[model samples]
Target: MQRSLLLRCSNSIFRPPPNSHRLRPPSLKRQSAPIAASSGAQLPLTFSQNYRTAPNRLHCSVSESQWKQDREMATADEQQDPRIARISSAIRVIPDFPKPGIMFQDITTLLLDTKAFKDTIDLFVERYRDKNISVVAGVEARGFIFGPPIALAIGAKFVPMRKPNKLPGEVISEEYSLEYGTDKMEMHVGAVEAGEHALVIDDLIATGGTLCAAVKLLERVGVHVVECACVIELLGLKGRERLGDRPLFVLVNST
Candidate 1:
């Protein structure tokens, strides 16, 4: 059988292997363990377990109909938060453009729907508005879109982590390995003050090279990275494991 595609593209970004044909179930042995969000609400153990086992994953077998039902249920729960459903629906997927057999999650479609796009920003804004974050560091160039809006809403400064030589100022850079090759990300020196709390933003997390590089750059400068936030997480790639102990939050989990 031909492999399925999973594309992660926004300006310059990473892509996961094109083989996420099914959504894997979490292990059945553990008793319920609650994972708390910033709102003090408990998230399900399945979501918690999946989030905790980043860079590594657990898969289980189930009938096709049952898997379909599970996905439908997950979608229904996301719709309970109207904004999430809107955002997910607005994203478009393109196949075989950058290369054959690649399924790309295209945010450009989401950007076209003004209401959906605004709601996406509003949802993040509402969540982090009171989190006391001082700097919102966005990875170029999609993060450029999502970060500034959230920063402005929350009264925090927006910092851009750019590609090598993209920033003209005295900048610090970190080199990270990608599935294709190595890439370097740079941040302007003094853009953030020491001991400030920061939140890292990106459009997607695939193998997590870019997000990991962004976090490393921030920590090397003495900035505390409170969390990493993305619009989508390609769960099959297990990017979360590469991020160490920092909590990861996403609006959509695409398997």
Candidate 2:
């Protein structure tokens, strides 16, 4: 059978092997103990039991499964979180922010509200509960505001992917373009361990160029980009299209 096309275009192209499929053990949900292989078969005296084993993944597998299960629970949509709803409603449309004919969704009003700020982080934490995110990489300025606490709540390491010389160390940089201007984002090589799964977090996505650069930087340091989550998506900027198959999770779609 073909890979789930929805999943392909949604999250980055990750099609697990058939054996790795998440399946409910077909039996009864009862106790957790040893049982005979069959009704008539005798249980082995010294059973060679490894309940949940996935090489190089003893830790990763457990974390990933648990997180996914958390996500499977009813998602906390914007309506459910009154704070999120309030924040969404309070987005003041500023005409010509930074340029002509650009009405930016001003988050300053939302940020000042304590409830709204907390809800925004909570929503993001819940949305990615099942992705076994090893690290949360937030961009400079506003990104730092929401990223750290989310990492602490989810038990993931927080790495700051900064702008230009903001990071004080030997860094890996990637230059990308945006609708209004171009800029470069950088990350320290030692921020995250190689092969760690990283979730990129940001306040908004208008062009997606910065986030893309962060992803590339994480890759350069050997981290697999697992997902990208945003607080708000700008109108008509189809940053999602530019992201292709990467997992892009967001709380608000302004468009």
Candidate 1, run of 10 with poorest lDDT:
46-55
lDDT of 2 by residue, 154-252 (tens): 889899988898878898888876434567888887778888998998877655667777888888878898888777654234455456666787655
Instruction: Please identify model 2 stretches exceeding 4 Å from their true place.
Output: 1-83, 179-182
Tell me which residue pairs clash in candidate 2. 11-247, 12-246, 67-130, 68-130
Please give each candidate's TM-score.
Answer: 0.72, 0.66
What TM-score, to 2 decimals, does candidate 2 have? Answer: 0.66
lDDT of each: 0.68, 0.59
| Model 1 per-residue lDDT tens digits across residues 1-255 | 111122112121223334443223333332334533324555333211111112233222335565455445556656467677677767655433355334466688788889989988887787788889999999988999999999999999999999998898999999987544678989998999889999999988765778989999999989999888888776556576567556777777665
Task: Kindly give the number of clashing pairs for every candidate.
Answer: 4, 4
